[model samples]
Target: MSARITLASGVTLNTQIDGPDGAPWLILSNSLGADQSMWDEQIAFLSASYKVLRYDTRGHGQSDVPNGPYTFDDLVGDVIGLMDALSIETAHFMGLSMGGMTGLGLALRHPDRITKVVCADGRADAPAPFVGMWDQRMAAVKEGGLEAIADGTLGSWLTEDWRAANPARTKSVRDMVTATNVDGYVACCKALQKLDYLKSLGDVKIPVLFVGGSEDVGASPETMGAMAAATPGGRYVEIANAAHVANINAPEAFNDAIKGFLGV
Candidate 1:
């Protein structure tokens, strides 16, 4: 089932719910330019054992795109508000890229609200280079819109071989990128530029599983492994031969790792 839920925060989010009526809740968050549909591949598989809830972030998909310069606090508050409105006290969360950073922030800020977190291809901190990269991206988007960065984003997301073999899927993802709201994309990028939660991982009391693609230069295995090492009892999983969007590039392997960690 799908609906547009208006949270107490005054933001309406596009959300979809699947699986049994009464089961453990698992929320899946998408990367920067994608929407809830990004998790289409894992919905059925995850729904078999858990009630899955996937939603578009504030600035993406069918969700409300408010004013720019959003912060991690705003992003995390969206999730908390959504859960509160739905009467969900706690739920498992899995996010990729921008979504992953939001997960880390959520766990750190509200450790009691998440049972476990699967942070895939996400960075905990935004260093100088990271901030500089996003600055360039934001400038490009402002100058030429999302079209200017769609190809580069796709290249970073999936490898050449994967894109060549999965033309249809690749096009679909590209369409998603091109269809995203430029203002929203830039706003989220601003939020990403201010990320600095790496050192705060130790404060996260919940279980966290850092998943990264072997070939993801943006969020390499070493980065995610370090994140896991920093967290008390956190674990890291590397999806071989995949890039940033590892779940889409290697769904089976990604599902196996997440399911194993979630014990579903």
Candidate 2:
């Protein structure tokens, strides 16, 4: 069932919980500009054995959009607050893009809260060139809105073959991107610009898995693999022919990788 949960910080996050209620807890966090629906595929596959929890981040889906210039701390706090509200002391977390970054922060600050973590297509830092690109996107959004970047985003998010073969899914992703709250999107962009969490990878002690898309320019497979190698107990996997959103573009492989990670 889906409902809204308000945190102590007064941020109300839209959440959906499914599967056997008594099962182990697992949290699915979505990418920037995406809501909980991004994990629909993963949820369906995992929920049978895991009590899955998926929530729209503070400003993305059915959640409230506060003012601009949010921080990773705010994002991390929201997830912890949600767990507390639901009386879950710990959970296995899986996140993509911005969501993955949040998992990193959560594992760092509240290591005990996460039993394991899967960071998919997540970058640990934003280089100057990427920051410049983000700045350009922010300016374009201010002028032409999310639509201005919709095509470009779609192009990067999925492989050409996947987009051509799955028009319905492509449309769904495009709509999700276009429907994103502008203020929230820009705030996240700014937060990403200031992110520098790569140096803290060694601090993460729990079992960690990093999944990357072979074709993802944003978070290349090599980079994700390097992150996994840096951690004390980390592993890496890459989905071939996948782009930025590997979980959607290559769900079968993604699910297999996740299941293997959990088995370890």
Q: By lDDT, who's the top model here?
A: 1
lDDT of each: 0.93, 0.90
Q: Residue-wise lDDT of candidate 2 within 62-134, one digit each (tens)?
A: 9989787989999999999999999999999999999998988888888889988899999888889989999
TM-score of 2: 0.98
Looking at model 2, the pairs that clash are none
Model 2: residue 167 alpha-carbon error in angstroms? 0.6
Which 10-residue window in model 1 sums to the lowest lDDT? Answer: 255-264
Per-prediction TM-score to the true structure, in the order listed: 0.99, 0.98
Per-residue lDDT value at 148 in model 1:
98
Deviation from native of the Cα of residue 205 in model 2, angstroms: 1.0
Off by over 4 Å in 1: none
